[model samples]
Target: MRITRVLGATALLFALAVPPAVADSAPSPSASGDDAAPTTAGTSFRTAAEVEQGQQATASASTGDYLYWSFPADAGQRPTVRATVKLPDAHAAQSWQIDVYDGLRRRQACQYGAQTRTAAQGAASVDLSCTLRTVRSWSEPWANDPLPGTYYVRLTALNVATADLGQPISASVRVGSKDVGGSAAVDGSLAEPLVPGIAVTSKSGEDDGDAAKSAVLAGLEPEDGWASGWWSDRWVWTAVGGVLAALAGVGGYALTRGSGRPGRVPPGA
Candidate 1:
């Protein structure tokens, strides 16, 4: 009778402990999520000269690849432009082209590059073992005169022999000169200064129409820095909860058996 009672108590304690375990395993709202739009830190022009030479330029290609420009956007002011390219899968891409564009999607500068690895070579490669590596990279400084105002960037990928798969991905940003006083756009209501880098504020009110028009003319996108998610995130929490439940069950079983050992004396008895 005593042994059975102890077992019952052990099971109850385990059941109680299981809830906490599951709670711990539960995924937080921030976890298991994809990156949203890029955050604006506001415009920061180091000197007056940079703001004066605002020229709108672009970099793009016929083939998909990477588009990059150096920061400090002033032609004579900054050095070392860096850029990122998100490629499709290796098997999905046979050839690549890169381009830079003005705000209007008109080509400004371009470079052609290709990356290919045999199925055997890629399968045997180090990068694709676990995570999918589907991105390319490029960077160049303002070796040429800096053109400011607004710029559009893009990368396109294609199948080797055919032009059928013309997947183009692009982003837009503003490049103000020092004359603009290193500008930033806000919702006009938030009145919050964006970070010190050139930015195109998405949030706009009637009062901000002028700023918005100027930004759009310069080729920057009106982004509130918010975009809907592609997939529901609730599943992530469900998965985390399931894991915790299992852990709690295991811990409870262990503790129950340990505490229910028959060797201990009962004072009430």
Candidate 2:
């Protein structure tokens, strides 16, 4: 009887201890658009600059026009970027595209859905979603790897089918990062920044010898920090250890208190 009671208590304790740890270890669900707010109204990449995670940028452009925005991401972080384009009702149908490029200006593959809208549709806006999993800063010299740096999102109007070349379409872009899990570098430092393509170009009429060298030096400087993976997370391991210790303690106690032990009898009986 005593052994059974002790075992039951141990089991209850274990049950109580595991849930919180699991909850802590699990990644939070992706956020909806409720918190997204437009932080920039600029239409060009250089003017828009870099946007922090969760902030949105609003821009107006026409067909064949490109709108650019940048987001800072760390290694091991999976960033989900979304863009919503509002079309003018005058057009019967339109298509829009979103492309993601790393800091080096190399285009990164993104899973996105093209938006096509018809005049009959009541909804004036269409959404485009792209997810880039696990940002890596390095690979073989010949390999193209998705690096952790400023990821640029380019929104373009593919087909407007309208006579008005100046028709304006509004776009809202948001970036969200979820820590999938990975260990940081041993030194806890970020990899080299990828140099922008135009960093070394001088004015049309002038030539500058230091442009290339300066750009290279700037790329070596760390722009963004590192993100830790699951292995580097100590709290999760500690929680796991606690659960194991509890289970082991219960097992050991059960073994010490033999299953065949006789039950205690009342003195009156």
State TM-scores per candidate.
Answer: 0.26, 0.60
Residues 112-165 of candidate 1: C-alpha lDDT, one tens digit per residue: 222222222112111110111111111123323223323333333334435423
Give all candidates' CA lDDT scores. Answer: 0.30, 0.59
Model 1 segments beyond 4 Å from truth?
1-72, 75-93, 103-145, 158-269
Best-matching candidate per lDDT: 2
Q: Mark the 10 consecutive residues where model 1 has the least summed lDDT.
A: 127-136
Cα displacement (angstroms), candidate 2, residue 131, comes to 2.0
lDDT of 2 by residue, 1-269 (tens): 66577667767865765433212121233344533444444455454445567666666676457777776776656677888878767655556677787777777776433323333333577788788756664556565667666677887766556573567677788777665543422223333445353334323214655654454322222233444322344455467668768767876876776766689998999
Candidate 1 overall lDDT versus native: 0.30
Error of 2 at 121 (Å): 8.0
TM-score of model 2 (CA atoms):
0.60
